[model samples]
Target: MNAARGGGSVENGIANFAPLAATVFLALVMLLPVGTGVANVMMPHFVLIATFYWLLRRPVLMPYGACAAIGFLLDLWLDVPLGLNMLMLLSTRLFILSQIKYLRGQTRLVQWLVFALFTLILYTLSWFAVALAKRDWLPVEPLFTQWLVTTLSYAPVALVIGRLRRVMV
Candidate 1:
């Protein structure tokens, strides 16, 4: 009985981290080499995509603490201002968590619209924050490209996250 209990505990531990593993994998994939080309000019924010996806799908699994930790790591890894990603991610989590009730049973189009709106807000906030921190207005082109690319990439990324959710949940 003790051996059986130990085996179950090990399984539970792995299960608990399944969501984190998947999101972290997606985050790493976002950093893959895409070469110096026009295609790589604008990269989608996969971490944001995955965070929003998991929070919406399984809020119980991806708590605010996990989201904050992921965002903090991203800030450190990317050498951005401390807490910038943390602020953004925590804000996103709060917004979605609060709205989960209304979001339930919604049509796909509605869900996508919500995601698009949040993505736009998230990008805008990042751009504004950077400008404020640097005390200079940055060029609009890069931020625009990133926002566009991320908004467009949402469908595919969300679809992949949905599949992963099935396995993890």
Candidate 2:
């Protein structure tokens, strides 16, 4: 009986960390060289997918602080303006957290649709922020391509995270 209780506790501890582990893992993916043939089509936003997934599915497990840390790390890894990704992620977290009461318990399709819409907004916001910081307007083509690719990436990435959640929780 003692062994069983210990095992349960151990499982619970690991379960608590599952969401965070998943998010960090996705952030690492953002660093990979997966650019497209297009002139400036950057890699899809893997970090956003993970952040949105955990934020929507298990907000308690994934805190805003952790999101900020991951965003900071991503900014460093991707070499973007310091705190740019951090601001983007924190804003996304806050936006979703505000609407989470309504989003919770909704069907997966609804969740995915909402996420796609959020991705659009996030990409635009990030693009504008970067441009404003640099004091110049960057072309929108690459940003649009990145947004489209990142939006398309949500389905597969969310499916993986959902499956992991089922096993972990």
- Per-candidate TM equals 0.87, 0.88
Point out where model 2 deviates above 4 Å.
1-8, 35-41
Write one digit per residue (lDDT tens) for candidate 2, span 46-87.
Answer: 888888888887888888889899889989988888998888
Which candidate number has the best lDDT?
Answer: 2
Model 1 TM: 0.87
The TM-score of predicted model 2 comes to 0.88
Over the stretch 1-169, how does candidate 1's per-residue lDDT look in tens digits?
7547665565566766767888788778777777585555556888888877777777777888888898898898877778988888899889988999998778867887898898788878888898999899999888888878888888898888788667654
Give the distance in Å from residue 45's predicted Cα in candidate 2 to where it truly belongs. 1.2
Clash count, one per candidate: 0, 0
Error of 1 at 85 (Å): 1.0
RMSD for each of the candidates: 3.0, 2.5
Clash pairs, model 1 backbone? none
The alpha-carbon deviation from the true structure for residue 40 of candidate 2, after best TM-score superposition, in angstroms, is 7.8
